[model samples]
Target chain A: MGKVINGLDIESLSSLLDEARKNKELVQKISKWYARVRWAGTGFTFNSYVRNHSFTISEPSELGGPDKGPNAVEYVISALGACYLTGFILNATKRGVNIKNLEIALEGEIDNILVFLGISNEGHPGYRKVIAKAYVEADCDEKTLKEIWEETVRTSPVGNTLARNVEIVPQLSLIK
Target chain B: MATVVNGIKLEDFNALHEELKRNAEFVSKIHKWNARIRWAGSGFNFTSYVRNHKFTISEPSDIGGADSGPSAHELILTALGACYSTGFIYNATKRNIQIKNFEVAIEGEIDDILVFFGLSDKGHPGYKKIVVKAYVEADADEKTIKEIWEAAVKGSPVGNTLQRGVEIVPQVSLVRK
Candidate 1:
């Protein structure tokens, strides 16, 4: 029913159209919920304000961010996991599945220094490779759960971000 | 205002012991706040550690926190925003919104120099005021997405901390333990 790559049935290219349409709508909704405020000072004193209810985003560490604060690249990984988990949960709930617990773990590798230096776009350390494992506690059959999980990823936000190429044109403002 | 330690005012460092008996939490909070001292030596060498509950500083100074540490106050904001962001993501994921990403950019105000000097002022060194903006991108319509975000923020751990003045108590652990 689909293109087979290394014995794995890959999604048809036609599916990308629906994915793009849904992504466009989702991006707009996410944008409206987003906001930021400056801490008003130098690099050491720079501050920003955000509400938890808005879109999930963090500024760069060079701009007075706590090293604990997720950098732009880290945020990308977080987004994929979050989107996948959320998608799974919604689908499970709709099916009246009695899920006691759900967890998603993701490990990704990227070239941190190369991208930072702007030397090679070829290996921009942007999740060069990612592996995700989902753990679910449910009463459904394995076959049914597997199908649902696959469907969820196909429609999840983070998965789409990784599968598609996005162009980001950020505008910078100087501190007054 | 000079907070009293035991029977003496906080200004009199020696008297702080006396005031410690009367109001322990207040005294403790002060002790935690002043855990680190900055001296003009080779450069800006920090001697303090702000943990989940207390302020800590070692005699040698180079412990968990070094020159790269976020000032004692920055930790407070970090904890608030990080806590809120983490909580919001957990909740949103459980709700099944296909939320792809979560980040918190927090800004705080500490315009007063008194905070730096450790004076007893109405504003806390922790954060006079803080603003946290969260961005959540999901695969849902605008209305549904907004509702999920609202629910996540209102119920997040960090959001709760910011809404209320979380208690800050200082404690120490034995290395031998």
Candidate 2:
């Protein structure tokens, strides 16, 4: 099996690597991201971009926002869940596993938004703890799928980043 | 100058903080978040919910996505910018300074997408470094505004979180349903 498995094709990926190696311009590639927030009537929304993709993030009416979209903290969790899921789909398929369905639920404990604004410095400003439950289903047995899961989490850029003393946040589950 | 500025009442905010302080039940605020992805015929799409707010997250046309929405990295940056900006408005207004125009440009450098998907374990998966530039035009002197900006970053939830570092890989479970 090449680098491409399931929906992920590793051949093209390798080709890119080959091109980079052949060119010798630089072996490492860095991704750039940009996010902009404009003033809204009562609140604001971010019109952000990454590699040409764009979207808006906002707060709900409860937070004095238009409730047009989700907040930054929420997006943090979204990034965690989404990043893991995407990695799994691409990687698992490469290993000859087909996912029937999958779901990952994430929960976290934060100090306080008030603390974040320096309103009160009593507690930590970031998340103190996080937990995730993953349910997975695939062509392989639970053990084998879990082996892949371990790899998924182990290899996940987001997962690994968060694991370095950030907080005790869990990330994974395959649909059974 | 009182804390109330830009129509946001600081007294109200103070009251909430005091209440939480007085009542331990309000302590250790636990925020719940959910994000689900479904195949959109050609690619995957996500609808994430938090604080009763919803939004779409997708890839651009380059990655075979419908280019329907922003990627996850973009959202993270958005959160940082918005949070910092909010802090600026609150602090500036509370100090009795009127803001003319404000802008915050945030940039981050990630190792590579291949590192993220585990194609190669040769690089760091998340952002190696992030740079932020804030442009502030206010009634007060530049020095004062800069001081306020410093306070904003110091007090910013997103800024602090990113700087302090946090967990990324959430624990997983196998859903039988």
Candidate 3:
């Protein structure tokens, strides 16, 4: 794990960024991000630890949870939306576009658990579609901004997973 | 706010398992999730609002912001990992497996922001693959536990997107407010 350092160590990260810019293939820096969740008998909520941070996730009371925190579904939207926004920031910065302000909204629709319940195979239980809108403020004209946005869809990994077609393979490990 | 009332409480969510076993389509319920994020300046940090859950995410100090919270990338993994764990617990409880302890860990590899930096377009900047491990302590044998694990994967919504594929659509707007 990298030290917390003096904030974001943009110097080191940028040096890495510079190296990546020079060596196209060198940019293929492989990284592992981790998240851990433990479920104790606490109102059906899980204490999740991620990158030295801990938070709680619980379903609605209708589902028998204490409703103390956001549900898993809410987190999904947060991830996708934030990922998309990050792309914009990265691109605008690289392009030298000064962003005065920026905001993004993300929404996804998924059937409640029909597939999860194994009762309905007619539609995907996961998000059938995700819609995201990024409201950006920058000095660039709309035409240039649109171009940046287009580039973002291609560059943003999280949004790309949703914007265009990509492949994700999942392997599960079980310990008894 | 729905009163913190107790009704049809599944007593450890086992009620869900029985429902799934009886009728598969019983899962046809639908819900929408929403979030709004804003970035004003410094560190590319973003403040997010979701169902009254307020938080901020900033770039590592290296990049600028105060490192207020985990990067978006970290949150992505957290969402996936937590969702998968939820699936396992739901499945195990449904299977009547008495879980002594339960936990899950998720790890994935994402290409550096070279692509976003306009450095390289040779590869996908997102995760190439996700590896998940569940440490489950239950009264059942390994075989039964394995079965429950499979069941969880088969039903996990987050895992399904990674295992299968889902479409994400994005729209961009320029607004002052």
lDDT of each: 0.37, 0.58, 0.66
lDDT of 1 by residue, B70-134 (tens): 33233334444544443344334334444444445555543332222122233322233456655
Provide TM-scores for the models: 0.38, 0.78, 0.81
| Interface Cα RMSD, each model | 22.9, 8.7, 3.8
Candidate 2 lDDT by residue in tens digits, A1-176? 45434444556544544564444333343366666664342334444545555456565544444556666666766766665666666556556676776667777556565665455777656655556556675556777777777776766555544444222111111111
Best by lDDT: 3
The residue ranges of model 3 lying beyond 4 angstroms of the native Cα positions read A1-16, A22-30, A162-176, B1-29, B61-65, B111-113
Question: Which is the winner by TM-score between candidate 1 and candidate 3?
Answer: 3
Grade the docking of candidate 1: incorrect
- Using lDDT, rank the candidates from best to worst: 3, 2, 1
The local distance difference test score of model 3 is: 0.66
lDDT of 3 by residue, B98-120 (tens): 56677777777775555656666
Question: Which one wins on TM-score?
Answer: 3
lDDT of 2 by residue, B1-177 (tens): 655445556676456546655665545342444454432322345555554555666654444345567766666666777767777766775576766666666776665555654455686666666666666655677667777777777776666666565654455555565
Put down candidate 1 lDDT per residue, A72-162, tens digits, no spaces: 3333333344444444544554455555445444444442322222222443323345555566666777776876676666554334334
